[model samples]
Target: MTDVIEREIKIKLDIDPSQLVRNLEKEGFEYLGEEEQEDVYLNGTVKDFRDTDEALRIRVVNDKVELTYKSPKMGKDSKSREEITVNLDNKESMIKILEKLGYKSSYVLRKRRISFRKGNFTVCVDNVEGLGNFIEIEGIDVKESDLVSFFQDFKGKFHLNGEPITKSYLELMVNKLDNSNPN
Candidate 1:
């Protein structure tokens, strides 16, 4: 079992990831290779996660499966929250267990992620199958007071001109699908 506080920022990018990779390399961030990740989001039996701002997900990355629960963001500036994660031995069994417990599958997100590491922060440039490209900076064990400044410095270093995205990828995908299909 692993429990930690997650402080992060997501920026929607208009530029290509290869370009971003070169830029990050120039700034001395080490390339940490890439991986394909599949995330299955689950809805609670009695509570609507959308309304509660919480998430329960099973993420498969590099043949390993992890069960993660994220609480709602606590403060205003950055997406800082408590994250509890556990490793699962069997993906199929875990899925079946969640299903039996009335946790319905909300959505599945597939993405190709390129990762970089600099100091205590890990940066992921994600190419989501349906939602396009985004850059996310995540720092574990970060102080609450430094959340906003950490994001600001990262944004400045990356020369990210777009506004920071507040919504999660699941929310973005849900909104996109909703907009595409007329009521």
Candidate 2:
């Protein structure tokens, strides 16, 4: 079991991914390859995740699967929180366990992520199935107080002038799906 404090700044990108990659490379950020990931978000039986501001999900990245629980945000402006993650070898059995425990699958998110690393921060450029492109800069070991400035500088380097998006990918995707299939 690994417990860590997660912090991230998310920016919804309207620009091309190639341009972002070029800018990042120009700044000497190391490319960390890419992977396709599918995340299955689950709802707790005892409480509503939205009301609690928490999340539980099983993330399947290739043959690896991880079950993660994320607590609510620690600050208003940044996505900082406590994350507990556990790796599982049997994804099918885990899914059955969760289902038997009354945790229903809420949504599934699919994305291809290109990662870059610089210092303690990992920057991921994600192309999501329904939400388009986004850039997420995250770290578990950096100074909490410096997140604002770091995000600003990172965005500045790419000439990104848009406001940062605070909503999680699951939240955004759920809302988008709901809106599209109106009853």
Candidate 3:
């Protein structure tokens, strides 16, 4: 298992994903390739993950599967949290184990992500299955202010003028689902 502090910022993209990629390339960000990821979010038996602001999920990318635990968001300006991840060899067995332990699957999020890198930061342009496009700038073991500043600089460089979205994709999906099927 590996643990790290995830500090990042997300911005809703107003332009197309290709345009964003081109813009990033022009700004000296090297394209890092694309991948399709499926994330299955699980809820704890005793505590609701949404209420606790924590996350437990299994992410499947290509042939690899990883189980991840994310702590609640910390800083007000950014989504800074402690993330622990463990790679598993058998996805089905791990899922069954978690289910037997009372962790129930809550939501599934799928997206196509194109990654880019410039310096110490990695930028991802994501096209979610249901949700729209978004740009996420992530830095590991970095100060919250520095990350935020980098996000601001990136936004200005790309002529983007949108408020940063701190909510996770799972939260956004849940909200969309709830709104669509109102009780």
Candidate 4:
């Protein structure tokens, strides 16, 4: 069995989620889900960032609160996903709590994520639920697991599942809810 760990860290981004989506497409990435994840996603993409041999995930809006569990990938056909997740509600209010807690909202496009070992954690990436893109490596790190290691190590990372992942669920919902850009 492989040693694994579970942990998550979310931050607010400064980029226009839609613009980030466009940049991802220009780099050969495409949306992977428009249905699953949680029904919040509007434009999700399976994108790899610049200057990398493999894809680096860059989602628009992830859930404000999330939960995760990790263990091992087991095998190629491992059905369990080896993950456990819990998503909190009232994101608007939670953001206020997060702000008070001192965790700065992030601005780096591909720099936001919750990492696990051996592929297991899942939740809203960019506010998209049921289905969102993901990346994972195939190894174990326990003595000192780095949160960023998930992106740094495996390099075997890939999109989660489904079709046409939204660019930004917020904007998507906004357009649907109002039919006009908020900004």
Candidate 5:
């Protein structure tokens, strides 16, 4: 298992995806292909992951599978956290093992992600199944100021005027489900 600090900022995209791709290309971001991803979030029996603000997820992308644990958000501004991930050979077996260990599946988030890279920063345009389109700027082990500045510059250049969303996809999905099925 390898551990890394993941820092990212998410902005809801209001414009067309093709326009965003054009903007990225004009800014010299290299296309990195696209992939369909499914993330299954799990909850521990001993503790509520929502209350603890931590997450355990099993992610499947094409034929690859990974088990990841994300610590609580580190700061108030961005989604910075310690992420530990292990590549797994079998998704079903891993899910069973986690279930046996008292972790139960909570939610599944599916999205189609188109990726682009320009330096240490990787940009992803995501079309979530139930949610709307979003753009995420991710940096690994980067300084907070640098990440923030990069996002600010990118936002200004791309004419992204909306406020950044700080909530995780899981949080957003949960809230959406709760609101839709208020009983």
Candidate 6:
């Protein structure tokens, strides 16, 4: 099982992100962000053709995109996952790509995200359609000094102090996309 702990943070944005990312790179960090294309999902709905045991996702980077599938896992804190990602640009080709690789393509998306960490302080840039661009921070097993340092650095870059989130967007979607109630 993967052991790295995850944290969630959000920051408001006002400036051009391209220039923002370039500035971050010069400050001894790398930009990490991806776009996600999500297949329609609904809770307690019957589907013979789709797999619910996995959350299918697509991630886009600067040079290329990636196809990934994460197995559903239950944990004390929440469900965790193990993922496998491959470089590809277009998500529509995944079914054929997976067939060629002798794997299954259950779902696909076009997602863009940028994230990085300095020590235990982590930051993310996410762009999801209808949601817009967002900045997130994950303070994983961090020390007080590291937290203070990031608070200053990140606060200086963007207006922040947004709270953490426990539910993922899919979880939100399931409730929002509901067509019928489960008994």
lDDT of 6 by residue, 75-168 (tens): 2332344555556667557655545655454322233567766566656666655445556555644443455456567766654444434445
Across 30-53, the per-residue lDDT of candidate 3 in tens digits comes to 989999999999997888888999
lDDT of 5 by residue, 95-118 (tens): 999899999999999999999997
> CA lDDT, every prediction?
0.87, 0.88, 0.91, 0.32, 0.92, 0.50
lDDT of 3: 0.91
> Which tens-of-lDDT digit does each residue in 7-71 have in candidate 1?
87788987778899999999899999999999999997888888999999999998899999999
- Greater-lDDT candidate between 4 and 5: 5
CA shift of 176, model 3, Å:
1.2
Ten-residue region with minimum lDDT total, candidate 4: 48-57
Runs of candidate 1 exceeding 4 Å displacement: none
List ranges where model 5 is wrong by over 4 Å: none
Clashing residue pairs in candidate 3 are none
| TM-score quality measure for candidate 2 | 0.94
Worst 10 residues of 2 by lDDT: 141-150
Better of 1 and 2 by lDDT: 2
User: Quick one: best lDDT, which candidate?
Assistant: 5
* Stretches of candidate 4 exceeding 4 Å from the true structure: 1-9, 39-125, 128-183
Question: Per-residue error at 141 for model 4, in Å?
Answer: 11
**Candidate 5 to truth, TM:** 0.97
TM-score per candidate, chains pooled? 0.93, 0.94, 0.97, 0.25, 0.97, 0.47
